[model samples]
Target: MNRHRFSTEEISIFRRSLLAWYDIHKRKLPWRDWHDIDTNIVAYRVLVSELMLQQTQVATVIRYYETWMKQWPNIKSLAEASEDDILKCWAGIIIDSIFYWSYFFHLGLGYYNRARNLYKCAQLIINEYNGEFPNELETMINRLPGVGRYTAGAVSSIAFNQANPILDGNVIRVLSRMRCIGSDLKKKSTTDFLWSLATDVVCPERPGDFNQSLMELGATVCTPQKPKCNECPVQNQCLAYQQQKEIESILDIEQCSANCSFCLKSSDVDTNRSLVEHYPRKKSKTKQREETSFILIIYRLTPKLEFLMIKQKQSNLLSGLWSFLEISSSKNHLDQMNEQKRKTYIIEEIQQMPTIDTIPSINNIKLAGQCRHLFSHIDKQYIIYYTHCEQNDVLIPSTSMQWFNEEQVQTSAISTAMKKVFNVALPQIKLKTSNGKKNGTIDNYFKKKNSKV
Candidate 1:
């Protein structure tokens, strides 16, 4: 890899000029402004926004950040809110793998816990330090959870008046371009060198401002592509400028603005004419799977409307997701009961079969819905049937089953498939007494509920 070394004097000149340029051209952002900032609130916002920004674009983070801030204005509020609500906010963003989404939720829970720590830190500030954020970077960083070096540096340099160096994408880009370093930026040694350089150049008195300025220059004038040499304050000192290399034409300024990197590639007509046009391709074929099963469970409920939901004992793919118990046919039962007989048996068992006959209190058994939930790896078609009794029904479904309402179901940590099942199945079982005229089915219940509300 090609590498360039900078003399101590050259580094000093660059740092000083960049800081000067930042003073004049720093971009205005909401988080950086201290006026009217509730330190704890801003800290929480910063933490959430930063977490969401990982492997995601700034534009995508903006609306989500605002939505979350609006919903849970404080750490306590966020912690108290349902994970489902939070996950719903992250709906389209989640990769849809039950495992990934589950892990992501827990990861966010860590952040929420960190927010609580920030709250505690804030309380300390109000009680002891008179509401001022600690000026020391180490002190502040030590108080937050999951706040590693980069985040700590970002917060300290941007939020508090601390001189901490940040090694982020913009800084990496600027460093790569300025020093003409060709070593992969992803390599640890290259990153460490950049961090050392960043630390060495950070101005203590205006550490935060100077650091932000470096980022600003990298983001704007000394951008990843088509750096505006005429507008750049330190163009005279730039090695790329002095070398008079083809670096300036490395990126097409217009194409770069439109997120068209391929378009930026210089194409000479003669060499490329024989190739096919790049874009359209036929869709790949998907395999069709055939699965048959009888999802069996007796839905017994208490008179007061608490429906049973069971958690699985075995850790299957949708291990943590909820569903009624399924009874798989042994080879003999399946062989003996032909397809039609099997279907009839399933309906009868779901509607009338009770492991326990009478609830200790008033409870009834009923049919819910028959539907299917499709997952990427498996398709779960459920023959969901429901039965109900009063709140104090005869039996609570052993340790596996707990009663939950529709609203509660929304917040439960269930699989996307289970969520789909709940959305479809919940409306089928109605609690109210009808004139026996299909009085209160799930659809009608929802319609009436919506209209009344």
Candidate 2:
């Protein structure tokens, strides 16, 4: 790996400039309120903020963070809280944008696995560490279920004031541009090299502020697109800026290398301002795999209406979360089946289940149209089917399955995918009752329940 070496004076200038800029321009976030606070409380706050900020934007996390602190306040309180309550707290942060015509939200708060992991993490800390967060990075990573390298480093440096290096996405972008590293970020070798650069430049005296300054600079000034290079405090020490200046100094620009030595990519460099934005070239994203599932929104018209929901197994993708009964087409031997055969296959599979002995006639079942829910690497297509069964015909569910009334389903720890399924299927189910299609009863239920958030 080709490395950029800075002189002692250059490194000193870089650190001083960045720290000075950070002191003046840092965003006033809830997690950064470290003044007059205990070390344990600081550690807990940092842990929670880091976990919440994973793959979520800062603007989205701020209100959620504030609400969480008010509710839980500390690790002990969080540990004592129920998983359902924690999920409710998380729901406060989730942004649900409903399109006019579609029942599915554009983005759902689909972090069910992370929420479960957080519950287990809080329990682990309370039981193992006596309600105190671990200070050592190694212990934090080893003992905590979901604390990865970046999170561990952030907590150790920010909360404990330890001289640790963090390589989050923001820090990676900052370091890559500052040092003119043009390697593919998806490669492990490139990531290791960036971590080395992070370690090399981290200030020993104020490790917390110094590390955060780099990340802040990336988020505020050194952005992914159209970065404000002229306003950057450490522009003097930036290798990418220097390379851009060199290209701009050329008399015959066409004679210069189309692929410059810094980024090793073709570029005109006609505008020095835009050159810095091109250094951290990212690799193309991998295509998401397509998956199809048959979701059964089985309901009974008892004295009060009740829906059948199943708890996801520990071995499943959304472990410990409750969702509608889903039969993946892959497992049902319907990969090659036609549309009619697929529906038939789903009905046959549901009939075979021991817990559900009798269901309504096929003519009475209604298809509530298809809805999509996206995971990190899977594009899930759900064929929602609504069926009504008699109360006497519906057998008592085993330990894995439970019958939930409208109120229970509304307040349960169900995934956003299941929520979408419910939102689409419930209206059709209501049409069979006295309430007409335009009554908006299901919408009222979700609004009344989730409105507190």
Candidate 3:
């Protein structure tokens, strides 16, 4: 592979072509609005856009971004808003596969924490910087919660007009193909090299446009599968193109560290293909860990139907969010328990609850269908159970427990996992109610039973 650096003339040509192409083809995104160039406004817009775009598609973020800007136009406003409101705004923006991507970055830290950090970050900026977003790279990184190298660089360069480098997935793809970087993109060495190259090529005069152009090029022309090589502005300077043309002659072979399937060059004609297709190789990703848990959808009728939900402690995962009563087991424990054992375990755990004695007989508990929730690193299987009792038999609400009707549950600060569980239980409840039995009748019967007792 050609590892030579671009000449000064070549670099200028690449920049000129890229910028010209971007001028005509650049996506007119809400955050990229050039009408409001005020530094403070620009910084806030860039920061919010960056956070929203994490593992999210541009189309998906546009609506959310516009809505968010309308609702919380400034950092102070966002800081003043409750966490539940912010999270509810963030709900649908996270697409299915992208959730996994976010999970990978956050690992132990759930995506809800991102919302929490964004809140804290806004508060910090308001308190320390007097509500003005910091322009300096180090200041932004040090002050903002969850603001790392990429986010800091992006905000500094795009909003503040500072000459900084950014290396998001799109930028990485563009760089890897441009230089024919065969090393695993996940390696620290490869990342450092790419950052250095990005810094080197960034236009000093218009660093924001330069960086954004590279990213836009990757997003539009140089896509991962079936790249538009003919339409790429920087194709003339791309070493991958040159390598693809000459791969037929170079006999000496080296195994690709990325283990990519596309660029395998062999002496056999059948195996020979363009090496350009595999320029930006990547190591295989680890499989998602599978886990099993039991979610209890307990309800009570006291003239009105209310479902049981638990508020997660502020310190654990999904902190501050409410979810259904769940008995979760790690993969190891799941392996130890057979299907029957798992069912029994769930029942025993529910029976052991302090408030269990207050509820009527558990004989009527019905096993609802299972639900599958995919996180970044975990594939969770949730077995749902539905049960209800008379209002007088229901336990009193505690700090961590609450009873909510359907509408309340819809608006409550509930996790997506719990929402899935609710979705599963809703149909079951609807089916039961659809058959002759009326909610009002059930409620009156339970109320009369309580009064008589």
Q: Backbone collision count in every prediction? A: 22, 0, 0
Candidate 1 per-residue C-alpha lDDT over 149-254 given as tens digits, one digit per residue, 9 for 90 to 100: 7777876766665778887777765654555443434457667877876787777777667777777777787664456767877665555454434335432212
Q: Please give the ranking of all candidate structures by lDDT, highest first, separated by commas.
A: 3, 2, 1
On a 0 to 1 TM-score scale, where does candidate 3 land against the true structure? 0.57
Model 3 Cα lDDT, one tens digit per residue, 193-246: 888878878887788888899889988988877788888888889877766665
Off by over 4 Å in 1: 1-16, 36-38, 92-143, 245-453
Question: By TM-score, how accurate is candidate 1?
Answer: 0.43
Better of 1 and 3 by TM-score: 3
Q: TM-score per candidate, in order?
A: 0.43, 0.56, 0.57
Model 3 misplacement above 4 A: 1-4, 95-109, 249-273, 285-453
Native-vs-model 1 lDDT? 0.55
Tens-digit lDDT string for candidate 2 (284-335): 5434667888897878766677898878889988989888878887634655
RMSD of each: 22.5, 22.0, 20.6
- lDDT against true structure, model 3: 0.76
